[model samples]
Target: MRKLFVLLISIVVLSACAPVHRFTQLRKLPREYSENYSIEGIKAPRSAAHRKPWIVYSDRVENAAYVNPGGRVKSAEVGLLDTFLVIKTKGDYLRLIKYNPTNIKHNRLTQRKKAEYVGWMHRSRLILSPSSITDVQSGLHDKLLTAITDTTAIMQSATYFTTADSLKVFGDPELQNQTGVVGIHAIIYALKHSVDKRSVLVSKTPSLSADKIGEQVIGWVPAVMLQEIGHQVFTGTAFSRVPTLQKTLKYAPMIYPYHTDSTCSFVSGTLEPVIDKKDNHVFNINGKRISYTRGNQIKQELKRINILFAMEQSSRLPEQYPMLLNAIQNLGPFFAGSGESFSYQFGAAVATPRGMETIPLTADYEILIDRLVKMASYVADTENTPLPAWKAMRSALELIGNTPEAVNLIISVGETGEQQENAPSSIVKTLNEKNCRLLGWQLYASNDDKYNNYVLQLSNMIEHYAEYRTKNKRNMILYADQFCRSNLLREAGPNFLMLDYPYASMTQGGFLFPEKGETLPMELFAGAVDSIVTQIKADHQLLSESIDRAFATVGNGKDRLDSLLIATYHLPQGVKPNK
Candidate 1:
């Protein structure tokens, strides 16, 4: 009985260890052999192919290839013991496949530590799975770093890449072509220096369309050229050393357009001359004027004709020869009816031609030039002298002879107290007969006694002559200088009187006053004048009230006083009482 129990225990243990598919074939066996039948007609077990173990590093498994036998094996049915044994035999190969190029910790550890680990793997004692490794090489890393650095450099140097919605590239064809070449060269150079060769080829080639290429080229070329030129102009040299050359070179970039259009050209040649009828001189350059009274009709005509002739001649010359042209025509009518020699000289200079052309010898032109030259020379020579009365008279005659239409002669009179006492009465008489407008005789004022007496004598002689002309049906004007209150409204019962004041005040009084020292502030002087005007108006009102009161108190008797006040006030119409 004990032997039977031992055999049964043995059978039960073996059955438990049998393959699971053995039961599916039991029904086909004979009844006597069913419990102990040999599994026949089964296919011979295939010999296993040599398995090369691979270590694949993946997120789901850690150290699985080393610790687990069939973790990543191609066939899990292979004995787990056999898989673990195979992993051990090929550990070096597994390690090599699983090496991580970017393992910072492994790389940073001591060389001794790395060697110890490698040595264990070689001896098949240590295994590293493929999942722990990454296929990163030193050469590729260096290439990436270089590409990044190059891109940074390009971005830093690119200055002309603007984001404006609309850009104005100067539309000239020639300029655009030159700019294209420069821009393309610059961009290529920048790309060469800033990007990896491979990246530049890959990124910039096929993607850049023809339109984009042209726009970029055009935008950068002129910009770079202008920037370089600006630096040269500021720091490389002085302007005058090669001014025109420098200008020409700078405008080389602009020449394509400038040459084709008149408005675009940047050249100015010469200015035209202006003729001053009152001064009888042509203004060749600038700064010329003339003043004449109504009587100088002949001189005015001559002056106008001279200016027109000069302009006509100027038009015939090259346009570039004259940079500017300014003519003051018909200035003689402004002065009270008299033409002064100095005035005519000034007019002639204002109208003088600027070019080197042979001035046409028309009789009018010759006469105008002769008169102008004579007047200019005389004024230049006699500028400092006190013009004698007879000499002044002769100068007037010369002016009238040169300009036949000259009907009036204006002269400057001495100040109220300083008339030319020795002025010949006959000179004034002759001027009155000729209907001359004498001016500036009243302008002379000085602290000097002799000058004052001379001015007084001159004024008296002028009055005598004016009275004679009035009786003879001829017109005459005695313009007195209002240098002081005494000269303001002289009772010189002449047909015409004009008050002349100095345009500018001088420490030592004269027409062209010199600045001797600091002068009063204009604001203060203006304020003072305003105050004076207010006082004057108040005083005039008081005077009018007094005249009205007197008229009411003595109706008929006040007539004489009213007449006296009217005369004193110089009122054109008689004063009336208030309603």
Candidate 2:
């Protein structure tokens, strides 16, 4: 009898780990509504300003003022600069290098013996501009381009990585290549020339903290960070055209559809309003928002409260939703991006784009690139002047799209091999009506080991199939792995993809979504389209009114990415570059 009990328990335990599947109810929404969300997949972005002319300058020749560039800053600040080369600029700052003098090679800047990098310097004190660049060297353009392309090629080869405090793979020498330094400048060059280039500069190999064995291990900041930036810019570009009442919500960095709320708690990032004795909900922190007129503040706070209410009401687990709603409704209007939920909504709003028409001249694209540069600049300057979130969020709000046709949520498809578009056409239709967009794959996943032969075939097909429609399926198919090996990337097309949540985590062999119906991703997102609508409709009138107004804006339309950038950074008025 005991043995039977053990066997029965084992069966139940294993079954619990499996995914649960349930039928998604189809909503009778307009066909256009559903189609709005059916966004075609885009690949990783390629640079349009490939051969564009650019210039940057430096103030002092001292090498000691250099910073460790790339991925949230992993390397310790090292020695100063002994500058020999000037390749690119981001805003006022100049990225300097020292390559061979004789050949003036552009393909790669062979690292000098002891001349360490002196990172970005202000334009206010530029040592050389466009005209002066010729004085320094006549053929600066070709040399810089070669350096950029070669360095980019080398870094794009990186595939292996570590999060924090892990031992570096010494066998992997590619990560610490001498040419990587050149590539870093190449990135700066590209970024300075065009604010919206989502280049896929993956490292040739995973090399993290080779010099430090015992220190906390994280992935190589340069390549990983560049890729992440690529994702953000691409997201901004794809979302630029989402249907909305106004364009205010369009083209900011795309947010993920789901997030792992810091240990799967029943929390919401949507701020809630606290109830008052008069039975009126005193939305917008009673006296906290003194920054704004109390009435407007109240309206904004109340709107967030409604959003939270919508979230709670949209809960798929029927058993726990009411309590969740009641508990939050009573405790409304806390701080923005705070509460029982996680920190922010960016992660939950993310969706991968396999392809899109990248309009390089658009204001949204310009804003997208500017925000990216600002974020990196802030990271590089964090030691002296840290940009606080409160101030930054306001500035970021300017980037939000104001179009009425923009989408609110994105349904990103899975990797190529998986039936990524398996969410039934009917369900997809319903999603669109509810103001959600989808990012589906260009092709199914490859069965070939690591896509070796398959990649060659696809590349060749694309090479010849450039102008043909029917032959190449779609001219721009998503490269199955957004983090595909450096060699496997497409040479052209609208290369734009986003690495968010489950996808980003999955690529690194970290956390991934559990089986369909049974997992939280399914429970949270499965019926959310209708649920969000249902709950929002029932929210207070004040909430709806505020959201309506926010949908339109004057200056730069504000959105979450802009908010994120604003929250994290603000240029200090007092600080100036060292002369």
Candidate 3:
């Protein structure tokens, strides 16, 4: 009797310690669902709100599931308050992962073993809903980042962070360092901006791996290292009216080379994408999730151009020299005030009593006038000297460097000094090489068809403003002169601009000064200068608008870009500058 009793006790102990029998197939859940099934009496939770992939808790006292759909029960029973990950649905049945209620509070998943069970059950037998289940909320708000700094740490948990070696959620995918992530130029929609003391919560969009579990909790990025986007100084001007760089990016591959079509390009190279690294991965921000990828920074471009004045000072027009100098001097304030981004440099083609030569550019308008004034006291006949004018144009191009990307502008003032060298082709080639534009502002001069034709031959683009003309002379014709109007008219592109068009009896528009005498009043010169300055401002504004349009159509196509450039620089037939 004692032996039998001892044997029973040993069997009971052995049975208690034995591993619970579990279906091997039930332990592993499918990542995706098959066909769904619905039946009467198998209803979703009454309080459930969100749609699809609904997670719910067992409301009943007894919840038993089978290894196969509607098959014999093969798992232990669960009770009220237990959690289940709804895997799939069949006729009157549901496949689920029965997990511990405590485990549901964390982003961590309960691996299918011990506390977690996976099986199929009659939908009517168990009840759950989305609203009935609550998830862990980190209680962090989004932050506006100015920049992402080096040493910024990526965290795996919102609660706490471990050593850098283990918490490698992202960074240097090459695994260059302990962190599994690397930083690059990136734009991101942040999920959460910052945590209490340590890191900012960023998105895992930059992840190459589709880590559904690891991707959700992007971990924490060091808060101190993340910079916020700053405000603009001038918000109303055309230069400043653009979307903030952060507002324009979508939640996708965070790291990408700078795109010319990017709205940020509209604002020039002032702002760039921010990349934050925690552990070893690049993260993004702006109240959304950020993804990382390999990309290069946007190239910086030339925003402003250098404006060089190539004014002619002839010995015959003594009184006109000072007037021209005064006019050029006054333009300094107008150019500066026009809000056009440019630097002004002055040079003069002086035909003094001694000889004719081009004066070098000066920083100060007064200094340039002083030097020219001191060069020659005597003024003689307006010699047909185009050498000095040519020299002035060459000097301007040299100052800015004759690169294909050059954007420097040349403004030639005074008499229509036609180049006697007759090398219009060479001039055109040089101008094309530098991508420069020349504005010919002829004041108090006889209408020279030769000079007009010569100016038209220059490459790239040209703007001629013929000021103060006689009754018979053509006052503001674009590239076409009186004699060669038919031939040269065919040569002009859409970019060619002329004021006062088609020889109106008297040149109309604002202050009018006819070529009555050799010398004109300073007041008339000032008006002409004002008219020219206004035109310059209008052109500058048009260029700004073109740039905005070009970027607006970025990613659209190359044809759109070409069209935009053409439309902005060149006007169609019958179209005139806005008066």
Candidate 4:
């Protein structure tokens, strides 16, 4: 009897120590539907949301996952959260390595830090995609983000950063940073702005890559952020000044997730197909498990380019739908204010003059200006003219900008005393008809079309302003930037600086930089113009901050036009002052 009892005890102990049985497939629970992917190959399956770093919560395991296939269940059971850079998926299983979420909350980790791994978890346990979680912690009311810092959700979106000069993406912000997860409108706007800026990004360098634009632009923009703030200061007292332009971003696109159209190009995922009465698809937000079929699964792409992209590529696999949905529902412009403040308006304005040169003088510019005045009536709200307070503000902003000197940037050519940098005839010819030289730091020039393209941009804005005027409160800001850039350009000579558009976050949008058709939307033109105004005001602040933060990024000591002012000529170092 004693031997039999010992034998039974031994069997029980061994059973407890033996590996837990894991079926080839996980038990059916949430997301019963399944699929597989090639992990080590180029065709590894990943959703758009999963393509980037994402957050998830662990759940009560009905059937536990292992440290290894049959090892003891992992620790940190229910309340634990983590980030997974999912590399592969099969059935309900995801192949991944977990990174420290608790460490990220503490100061030990830099916000951009990744590349660490804990292990894997079942896909069913992902309570949040991170994309669906609001940056707002439920009921707390914070004004989205007035300023981004290291701990803010916006800052958390970045995985890497460098100085502005070291990087510059399309719209010139962080690239592939997974900012969409923040749910802040500005981050969304910035991400979208970065997405389709194919041309502007190309113009950024003779060539660019993930290392250049993505990492550096985010880092550099901050240092130069506050530099453009002075652009907003004017000669008026507080009373003389009307109300400040409402800092709200009126134009950011409303983003939501929904079923992608047949036009959506992603082939790795498919829109959840509707059958009889309901679908098994579900989107879990916070702890609430809701039917995903009812959400904003529809793709909201107003731009034809985006539409074409969706239609051109095959629809994604069912598993990739969430990613595809997030990709289409982009939002936010992010910065409310980003630069330095000045005491006097003119003192600041004169210090920040943008050098402008035209292709050749044209008589038609005056006609456009005349039409511009007529268009000004239409420039404000479609329902009414600008308010008295708005006019007071507008006049104050444009007063110095519309002078003959300001117009001269568009008309006359100032002489550059010295050809600081030599150009090949092709480049010189290109410079003559197209771009201006940025003779700031030491003598430097690139055969970049971005310079000449800027002139065309100015001409386009004036032309569009003359043609359409649908902006309500923002119309004045559009006029102000045009005026500001114009005045700054008057300070330029033929071989002068091209700094405004780039330093300005390339908010320089207007009428299509033409995709295919000659026709363009006045509304899009207006949106682009509004974007320019916002960035111009914002960049000054950003640059001010960056000048200190990202010091010596590109043109570290550049902006001292007063010291260089021997009548628009830049003197080499140690040159004596003009008597």
Taking every candidate in turn, the Cα RMSD to the unseen true structure, in Å, is 39.5, 32.9, 25.2, 26.7
Tell me how far the alpha carbon of residue 444 in candidate 2 is from the true structure, in angstroms, after superposition.
35
- Candidate 3: list runs displaced more than 4 Å: 1-272, 275-302, 313-315, 338-340, 343-349, 356-404, 414-423, 446-579
Query: Which regions of candidate 2 are displaced past 4 Å?
Result: 1-319, 322-407, 410-430, 433-579
Estimate, for each residue in 10-76, the C-alpha lDDT of model 1 and write its tens digit: 9877765532211211111122211111232222222221122222111111112322232344222
Question: Model 2 — which ten-residue stretch has the worst lDDT?
Answer: 306-315
| TM-score of candidate 1 on Cα atoms, chains taken together | 0.20
Tens-digit lDDT track for model 2 on 224-271? 223211211111222335545234334433333444855322222221
lDDT of each: 0.26, 0.26, 0.39, 0.25
Judging by lDDT, tell me the better candidate of 1 and 3.
3
Tens digit of lDDT per residue, candidate 4, span 438-505?
Answer: 11111112234432333343333333332232121122221223222221121122322233443332
For residues 436-529, could you state the per-residue lDDT of candidate 3 as single tens digits? 5455544453455534433433312332112212211221111122212221121122222334323331221222222523333456445454
- CA shift of 284, model 4, Å: 55
